[model samples]
Target: MSVLSDLKTVAVHRDFRKLFAVRLVSQCGDGMFQAGLATLFFFNPQNLATAAAVAGAFAILLLPFTLVAPFAGPLLDRWRRRQVLLGGNAIRVVLTLVLAVIMVTQGVSVAVYVLALVTLGVNRFLLAALSAGLPRVVPREQLLMANTLTPTLGAVSAVAGAGLGFLIGAISPAGVLKDGLTLTVAAVLFGCASALALRLGKDQLGPDRAATGRGRSWAEVAQDLRATAVDMADGARYLVRRRTPGMGLGVMAIHRFLYGVNFIALILISRNLLNDPADAGAGLATFGLLAGLSFAGNGLAIVLTPLAHERVRPSQWIVVCLLIGAVSQGLLAITPAFAMIVASAVLLGLSVQGAKIAVDTIVQRDTHDAFRGRAFSLYDMLYNAAFAGAAALAAAVLPDEGWSALVFAVLALVYVLLAVGYRAGIARIDDTPREVPVPQPLDEPTDLV
Candidate 1:
């Protein structure tokens, strides 16, 4: 069904509406909070002029929490999801306020970084809770529609929040005050989200006692952690046995690595090359415009991907995306003109989003239901780590101004190689019969939480 039809069908459910509100409001806050951070870290005249500095900032904020994410799943499964949503947003409200204060008083510092990490870490759990609790509120028949609508609308809300932050920044004088005010707005929204969470019953979003059993002892929790490690290893082995999905995952990592380098370059280019470094407001405005264009490219991909799929297999579609990425980077390699850069941003956005959609389809289609969760967990790890690794590589090679023809050329070549290699690898894999498990009843709600 069309997205609009799905929304109309699912909006009849009151609980779904409540949970949806929580998602929209909280994600909106997340967007504003991230916008504030971006200004402070990348666009500010006094902070992060060099690629290395930018790389350091990303590593400090992203890596530690990423490593800890898998462990959060087990805890999320144990906690009452309603409480998780309420408490998570409530905690974020407090942390964001404190972070705003630190940003205003001390500017960017180790303390600011640490607090940001904690705040973002809390956000991770909240997001997971939202996903896990989804099954509880929506009927099994409508789960797919609910899933589709929630994430898409949540993303739109986030973009709106970022736009609001930009508007606030544009009105306020550029500096710590602008960032602090943006964060303050984010904190208020977070509090609003927390209040909305109160509308759900304490156990409405549940790990139903029957499904989860009694609370685990410390030893049991440790054992579960150990078992999770083993399960992850098994999932890796399963992917290795299933060559198509494995290649898809590898291709995604390569794409993300290259895309991450491009992202870092764009930030530096927008901050220093496109605008005067001394004029922080101008740099922020330029970056914001480019970012909106990139998001516009993402919207275009939403339209283009299905059309491409009608003509080609998911695997072939990935090649098309990689080639598009190659051409975009190739343009940048030839020239760093503002117009070319703008076009490149739109194209790369299309390329990245298109590839990701194809990869997600391949993974889900090929992976067994039992291993799908682990497969996605692995995907998430690679997704974040690849970008972090790319930042480190960019720091080594990219200049302070972020204009490097050689880097762009290398990126273009890598994209081409990845496309060729991925296509060939998948082409050679023989079709093998796999076990097809019996389908479960849709009427029964899954105990995913």
Candidate 2:
């Protein structure tokens, strides 16, 4: 009962409530649509054209980040965060509505799919903005725990959505139109999320934005960033001068690289081996349940992490998680049954969440708040971009082998490399000791449950 009471308290924290609801709605909507997508792709012969259309849509919608993220970094201070959050949700609303229309209309052309994907991708940009905004609302001490909760919610939402979808799908026939209906439900929740973002006043978080001597022209902003990185050479040099917090960037870099490969591996596994038209739908449904279980583990971690902070070193856990991931992939490859596959997913989830919590704790504990969001955003972009590139490369190179073997091999290489590298990185760290400047308990006494 005390444990249950504690969870309720954490859930009620005003900031967590607002952020968690928004992420849950958006992810739920995505899950529904994702299930809808699989059903349409594998089962329907006529709508085969729509698969490429959706892929094209993703390509179009996600361009905002590549184009605007750098500029947004500077404006992160200037723009009203509430408005940014609202804007992102509002864009998703528009996208979802149009998507619903396309789903309902038989005459809807391939262009509709493209538009929807792009719009959804744009909505994801808002996701990043929200993540950046979160640290401001929550105390620095609760940051890692707070961060974990959202992913945990996202996991739960995936399960709920998948269950809802399977139920809806049981009644409705497979098609783009059916998929759109599921999306519409999520869109309504997304709109509610937008309203919530708007209601959450911005001033509570840190300085709204630092005054950058009157805004620079677009070209001028670009020039300033280029020069800024160059100037940071001194700071960079200082960082490397003797390890400490300096290697935070290195850890982030490697973590992102490995994560990129993992994302690609998931894609190949789903698209290839999971292709049986019948299995495709069930796989999506079950994957959500498995993912939910993963998030539950993550939530448990969030609840328990600060208490364990002294015991769980980021470097130590990073190495352990990498090994776990490698072994899980091997397990996944050999597992013939659906139930076994899920067990493998749960293990992978545990390892992934643990490593992420530890690394994020390390970064936030060591870096000042001023550069925090920008540093995170930059890291996110690189890692995500790497995900696409790795997926594409894997797609091209592993044309023959089954996705299971391909996925296993990729995981094997990644974990093996990471484990080896961390060993070397750690030894080099002892020699340099200055690189990881702050290796201490990350939680604040006041903030812990």
Candidate 3:
């Protein structure tokens, strides 16, 4: 089906509509917050920076939450996911408010960094909860459409939010105050997300009582922690047993890693190479343009993914995405022109979003709810870790100008190798269709609070 048709069909599902609203609002807030941070760190005239510093910023923003993933998964499975969505967004609002204050008063410092870390950590948890909750609202057959729409639209919402934030920045008095003001706007949007989440009942999205444990004594707490560690490991084992989701995750991880490398490279090139370094506004404008173009590509993927999936299996689609990545990398390596880089951004966005939709469906379909939270937490971890690792790697190799032919060549080689390895290793499985049971909701709804 076309994107519009799929959306029209799903839009009538009441529960899904609410869940989609939460996703849309929350991601839009995320986009605004992220743009605020970008402006504060890289785009600010005063913050003339080094590659390592840039990498460190990425690390500070993403890695801490990744470290928490192993434990977070079990809680996601243990706690009511709706509660996580509600409470997480609430905390995020508070954090965003605090972050805004710090940006205004503390400027760039450890305090602001600390607050940002916690905020992002909570944001990651909220996202995992949403992914885990998805099967609760939609049928298994529509998993592809569900994944395609929720995340794709959520991404577009985020881009729109970023654009809105930028617009605010443009009109406001140009100074530290503007960045803080933009983040304050993000806080308000997060508050709206909290409100939207409240529309869902406590048990509406769940690891049902049978799947979750109740409170226990101190000794039980220790035992529970031990069990959580074991369960986290079991989650890994579970994925290994389900070769399809495992392979899908592997593809997702590789794509994210490459995406991260390109991300940092894009920042460097835009800030220092493509635009005049001394003209901070020009640099910011160039990077913003690339970001907007990439977002446009992401929007395009919403239509492209389902169509491609009709003709090819998801795993095969992944290979096609990796091939596109290789070609994009090759273009960047040779010319390094602004036009080529912009095209590369678009290609990367399309390929990444397309692969992600396929992978989300595979994982959601293959993994049961009992372990789905953990499965997605691992998914989040791999995605973020690859991204952080890429930034670290780029820091080591990329020049201030961010124009590195060697890095581009290496990235292209990795994509090609991953594509070949996937074809040999996983895609070698028989292409026979498997029966998919239509997933039911976790529980009948209780009264909305």
Best by lDDT: 3
Measured on C-alpha atoms, candidate 2 has an lDDT of 0.55
TM-score of each: 0.82, 0.74, 0.93
Worst 10 residues of 1 by lDDT: 438-447
Query: For residue 266, what is the lDDT in candidate 3?
Result: 86
Model 2 off-target regions past 4 Å? Answer: 1-13, 33-71, 106-110, 173-177, 206-208, 211-308, 333-340, 399-401, 404-407, 426-449
Task: Report lDDT per candidate.
Answer: 0.78, 0.55, 0.83
Which candidate number maximizes TM-score? Answer: 3
Q: What is the C-alpha RMSD of each candidate to the true structure, in Å?
A: 4.5, 6.8, 3.2
Rank ordering of all candidates by TM-score, starting from the highest: 3, 1, 2
Please, what are the lDDT tens digits per residue for candidate 3 over residues 262-318?
888888888899877888888888999998898778877888888898999887888
Candidate 2: residue 30 Cα off by (Å): 4.2
lDDT value, residue 436 of candidate 1: 41
The parts of candidate 3 lying over 4 Å away from their true place are 174-176, 209-220, 431-449
Alpha-carbon deviation at 423 in model 2, angstroms: 4.7
Tens digits of per-residue lDDT, candidate 2, 7-31, equal: 4656767866776666777667666
Per-residue error at 310 for model 3, in Å? 1.1
